[model samples]
Target chain A: MHEMALCEGIIGIVEEEARKRAFAKVNVVCLEIGALSHVAPEALKFCFEAVAARTIARGARLEIVETPGTAWCMDCSRSVEIRQRYEPCPSCGGYHLQVTGGEEMRVRELEVD
Target chain B: MSSERIIQVERDILGKNDRLAADNRARFRADGVLVFNLVSSPGAGKTSLLVRAVAELKDSFPIGVIEGDQQTSNDAERIRATGVAAIQVNTGKGCHLDAAMVGEAYDRLPWLNGGLLFIENVGNLVCPAAFDLGEACKIVVFSTTEGEDKPLKYPDMFAASSLMLINKIDLAPVLDFDLDRTIEYARRVNPGIEVLTVSARTGEGFSAFYAWIRKRWAKLKQAERTAQG
Candidate 1:
């Protein structure tokens, strides 16, 4: 799964932060995952544990904050919340909705010792 | 006893890949090379389409290919047989190609200034959608034999692609593929996606594909000239 690669990216970020900030160990890694980002939180957790072994983030707990998917409905001329990309606008029932939010996968913060 | 402290990072998870991709894009722009990333499921005829396209367009334009696969270099071999430069990047347990891999592959190839570089991404619809290799556009190949609901099932890939090529159209009549519904589904996910139907076997609909590439290339050249002036 690509989650493994994403986890590797996370580890790289964490290790870099550790070097820059003079941190000895990481206790928790906070992530902001969007519902429409297509990345599964559970898979991220599984891969994070495997990829974090022996690193500064080894045994670190992952805290994933899920953000809702949001889109701008061109027909309704209003913003709408969507759970998926193919979803139609709730108000006008049109497929002309432009995704406005909830496609992010960011590492927001970290808890370190 | 050590105390735990929170550190604010505020970084995108794919930030490294994105930066690398931006670098690749700058390199491509400097060379005036129009690149397209071709993606699809396994056996969606990505290599076949490239073989046919390169064979016809090589005389008119200098073309190079980067073939990504998990194991074999067979697809690269197929492209090389057409007397074009093609390099194979074997991902080795990786599901998709990343920007770093593509950058390395591009470095290995000969200079292809004022030409086209086609990257045939590993035959996968899911993971490849997330990684950008600095391509001007992404073309997704959906064969008729793969059923129509693929766009619905794999909305991310469909949504990310700029153009969808309905491959294996010659087998559409023999199978129960509904061409209209497939287009509808793809459009539902991505309203701006362009669609074209073709068969690599019969060399059908390739003229339109070449025309599309030429149109984009002309626009790119115009933009480059305007930037210089």
Candidate 2:
């Protein structure tokens, strides 16, 4: 539901960059979605198509690059891959883990003219 | 004939909101205000707790509230009844309150040189987790009846929050609510999160909650003072 806001932000950036870089149209918008961010890539895609219908990114392909969740375990003093926030640290099986990555929802690249 | 090129447009989808959030943070800091963003599911006693807290603490510290709902001034009215200034933000169809909305609400709020402001976000777990409203810290309110699996089901919300208040603990005896297990689960999702159990009805555990607020508020003021020096 809030994906509409995110899509609008993306469109705002794309339009700004288009004006600055003199791009007439956009072809693809690559996004990096983090596992911990809880943003549904499919929903974002649907929103992108809908919100960008009349913008420069109209019909642009959305390429989602998923990033894995990473957290630092306090007990083990090491970083480990985490699938979910509630999952114990895979290395030391500890709950005292601080998430360090995989919460990104960014537009990494844009294929444009 | 057209040629396509991949432009390295590395930007966050939430960049605009995040930027506005930073601005809000700067404004709060300049004004020496401690702001908290409160989130919870619908019917989780968010407003009840806020009303109670404001009623108790407004005399000690000037308090303001921004109530977010899809449509309604009811929560704001409740907070107003407590004698604290409250602004109701109608998000319309929006599920969450973003920095822009908070920005507008902040402008409408009573100016406090150094005080506490609570933004009660619209009742939803998922969407609010992604939007930053320039709060000093995010607080999640969970009722005892909601079950311990809430952290697992809404990991993002728990992960984003710094504190979790287990509301309606007065009914702990009637319901099979596992206090220890709920804390453990909350810690599993947010390792550094501080959890406190309280019941707005019984006023139980509110002193601890109030103490926590005073501590944080003082700390924020101290930081501002130090920065000014």
Candidate 3:
């Protein structure tokens, strides 16, 4: 639902640009969901269409990119790849977890000409 | 420029939500709070276990809970009756509690300075596994009544969990529940996951569960103290 609102904003911009360019078709859309983003891919897929309703962006094929969750462990004194929190540091049994990356949910790239 | 061009651009579906989730995770670590995001199916007895655990440990360890649901603050109210502060996040038709929701929910909780925070995610097994709420751990709950094939059926949840709790064991004998097979299947999918058998309703096998918590709590506090000193 949150992502749909965001996608609506994106679609608006895309629509404006497409209309300006006078594009006939949008073949595919490439999307990335950060591991820690907590956004459901399926739900996002459903919401994307809902948000794109009555726009120049209906029935566009969507490509999903899943990014992994990364965290910095104070105990290990190193960066770690993590899918969740409260998990013991894989390298060292430490509880201090600081997520460092893969928390970005954005349109990394798109397919249009 | 009447010609339409196929543009190849890579983007994320969850734009702001992901950024906020990472922000929340960083904030949690910087704050030295261990957050456990609990995911389970409906009637899996997540709240029941939390209530029992809170009731038992409230006197010793300071804790708080954040309950997520599609509607109603009913779970929060139930948690509040245990004498611990509870905050509710209404997803309003959203099936799962995302990191942004957790971050907002935590801001609304009371007395959460260096306490164990349990986030009971909305009652669904699939999407909740896909999202990390910046919790110190993700505890997936399953009840005997839910059947044992849950692990293989929902391998994603098993794969995502650090620990799985098989609750409602008091009724295990009444129902044809097989503990060995359940744990085995779960282990097959997630070899590293720690599975604990418990019954929140009758306190069966709770001693081991409490011991596990005590160990986790001790280690967490020790790390925090060391970082400070």
Candidate 4:
């Protein structure tokens, strides 16, 4: 699964931050995953435990904040919340939707000792 | 006892890959190369389409191919048979190709100025949608044999692709594939996605595909000239 690779990327960021901030150990890693980002939080958590082992983030608790998918409906001329990409506008029932938010996978903050 | 403090990072998880992809895009633009990332599910006949496209267009343009697979040089071998430069990147346990892998593979290819570079991504519809390899656009190859609801089931890939090539159209009649319904489903996911039907077996509809490539290449060249001036 690509979640494993993504976990590796997370560890990389964590280690880099550790070096830059002179942290000896990480206690928790905070992440922001969006609904449309195509990342499974459970799978990410499963992989993160394995990937974070033996690193500065060893035994780190992962705190994931999920954001809702949002899109701008061209037909409705308003913003709508969507759970998926192929969803139609709730107001006008049209597919002319431009994704406005919720495609992000970001490492927001870390709790360090 | 150590006191814990929150460190604000605020970085994208794919920032490294995105940066590398931007670098690859700059390199391709400077070299005047039109890059297309071809993606599809397994057994979608992506390699077959590439073989046919490269053989047909090689006479008019300098073409190079970068084939990605979990473990196989067979596609590259098949491409090399057409007397074109093809490099294979085996991703080992990886499911998809990343920008770092593509950048390394591209560095080993021959000089291809003012030409086309086709990156046949791993035959996967899911993971590849997340990684960008600095291609000008992504083309999804959909064979008629697959279920029409694939677009809805795998909306991310369909949404990310600019063009959807309905390949294996020769089998549509026998398979009872509803081309219109499939197009409708794809458009439901991506209203701006362009659609083309073709069969790599019969070489049908390839002329339109070639024409599409030429049109984009012309626009790229015009943009390059405008940037210079």
Candidate 5:
């Protein structure tokens, strides 16, 4: 899955930081896992541990913060929170949802010394 | 004197895989092989159809297959039994196969000879559709047992696939599948898309698929040879 590579990528960033004498232990890595992104946190955690071998992130902790799948409802003329891709606007039930957010997989922040 | 604190760094995680994928795609194009990345849900019979197709085409043309799965080299082993070159890519816990995965598998393939390669993407109707592995076609293989509403439920997959092969047609009489309506719905989602109904077990419609693949492979090879000359 893309999650393995994605998490690996995040670990790469973390490694680069550690190379520059940042924080090798990682301490904390925050991730914004959008609902529509189709990434399973548990699976990511598993792959992270396996791929992190011999790297700076071998024992580093992963803090994943899930982001709700949201959309911009053309009918409501507003951005509303959604639970899934096919979900209608929360405030006004409509199908014309232009997904403005969600489907995001990014490292929101990092705690390093 | 100033008291200041700053942290700046840039990094990419997919560096290795992405680079491998690009090189694989370049080699594929250079070798005159048109790759097809096939994706669908598990038990969608990606292997069965591939086995049948391989059996039918192994003699006339050179063909290769890249099998992707969460674990086991079962699919790759099966394809190899058909007398064609095959490679297995175990994703471990991955729910989908990315271009990077395909690229890594390419390294293990004997792609020096001009041939056709089929990448059986990890059985997933969603994520695989989101990532392009530089294949000439993305074939979505599904079965009648999985229900015809798959296209409606998985719009992105239906939209992403250039061809839809509704397999297990031999079981249509036993199921409640409306073959025509299913094709109609798929066409509505992807106009001008090619849809083929085949039962890999019954040997029905194999000839047509063989012809389709031949046309594509021939076109790619012709283009490659001409471009070289």
Candidate 6:
């Protein structure tokens, strides 16, 4: 749903970089998406192709680097890996947690000509 | 044959939006306008609450509204009926409002002097949660009829919001909705999120909501003064 909008944003970045770095065509785009970020990888890929059409990134392959959701448990005072936002701390079974990582959505790298 | 090159972009996908959001934030701070982005699913009473709040607070402080929807300037019309400036930005096919769109709308809006501006985002929880609209904070509203499991289903929206307004509280007693459980579920996702129950139709909890807004507005005004001194 919103993946299309996100893909549009990605294309914007790609085009901006192309203009700055003097690249004509983009071959691969590696993206870092966190589990807790709520972005669907498959949907993002699908939308990326559709949005990237007729652009510098046309026919580009999307390389998604899925990052694990990490949180700091308040009760146990330790960093824990979480699968979902509503999930309790894996180590302490407590809901009191502060999310530390795995919420990032960024374009990590690009292969271009 | 063309040779390939690896460019270390390493940029946030939303970097452009974040930059524009910072610009919007600076403009707002310079003007001392307390801006709040109201987001939720459709029919969550965002416009209703705004209409009521504008009516109540317009006398004390100048109020403005930026309404976002896929189509229709009706919400803007409704807000303007309260004698305040309201601009409508139709997203067409876009599900959420981005910072660039908000910045454009802000530029067109009149009355840049000190006041409060409410940017009502298009009705969708998932997409809006990802896009920051350069507001001081986000306020997510959910009706009691939407069920308590909403937070569990849409954790990102709950996690991103600074305040959660449980709207339609007057219908809570009639429905099978468990208000306590709803608040508990919201806290499960967002431990620090402030919750307030408000019935925009009945004006039951407007006082508390207004108080929260006033507190933030005062803080922004104070910052404006300190920056000047």
Of 1 and 6, the candidate ahead on DockQ is: 1
State each candidate's clash count.
0, 0, 31, 0, 3, 0
lDDT of 6 by residue, B79-114 (tens): 999998999999998898989899899888887588
RMSD of 5: 5.5
* Deviating ranges (above 4 Å) for candidate 1: none
DockQ of each: 0.83, 0.85, 0.22, 0.85, 0.20, 0.79
Of 3 and 6, the candidate ahead on DockQ is 6
Q: What is the TM-score of chain A alone in each candidate?
A: 0.97, 0.95, 0.82, 0.96, 0.83, 0.97
Classified by CAPRI criteria, candidate 2 counts as high
- Please write out the lDDT profile of model 2 over residues B1-229, one tens digit for every residue: 7688878988888888899999999999988899999999999999999989999998898789999999979999999999999999999999999999999999999896799999999999999999999999999999998978898899899989999999999999899899998888888888789999999998999999999998998898788779889
What is the TM-score (0 to 1) of candidate 4? 0.99
Q: What is candidate 3's lDDT per residue for B1-229, written digit by digit as tens?
A: 6343556444444434557778987877676666788889999999999999888877876788999999999999999999999999998867788787888877877656566788999998876875667787889999999878888777668767888999998888889899998887776556678988899978987889878877887888898789889
| Residue B84 alpha-carbon offset, candidate 2, angstroms | 0.9
Residue pair clashes in candidate 1: none
**lDDT of candidate 5 over B150-170, digit per residue (tens):** 877776677668889989999
| Alpha carbon deviation, residue B162, candidate 4 (Å) | 0.4
In order, the interface RMSDs are: 0.9, 1.1, 7.7, 0.9, 6.0, 1.2
User: lDDT per residue, candidate 1, A27-48, as tens digits?
Assistant: 9999999988969899999889
Question: Lowest lDDT 10-mer window, candidate 4 chain B?
Answer: B1-10
lDDT of all predictions: 0.94, 0.92, 0.76, 0.95, 0.76, 0.91
Worst 10 residues of 6 chain B by lDDT: B219-228
Return whichever of 1 and 5 wins on TM-score: 1
Better of 4 and 6 by TM-score: 4
- Weakest 10 consecutive residues, lDDT, candidate 1 chain A? A90-99
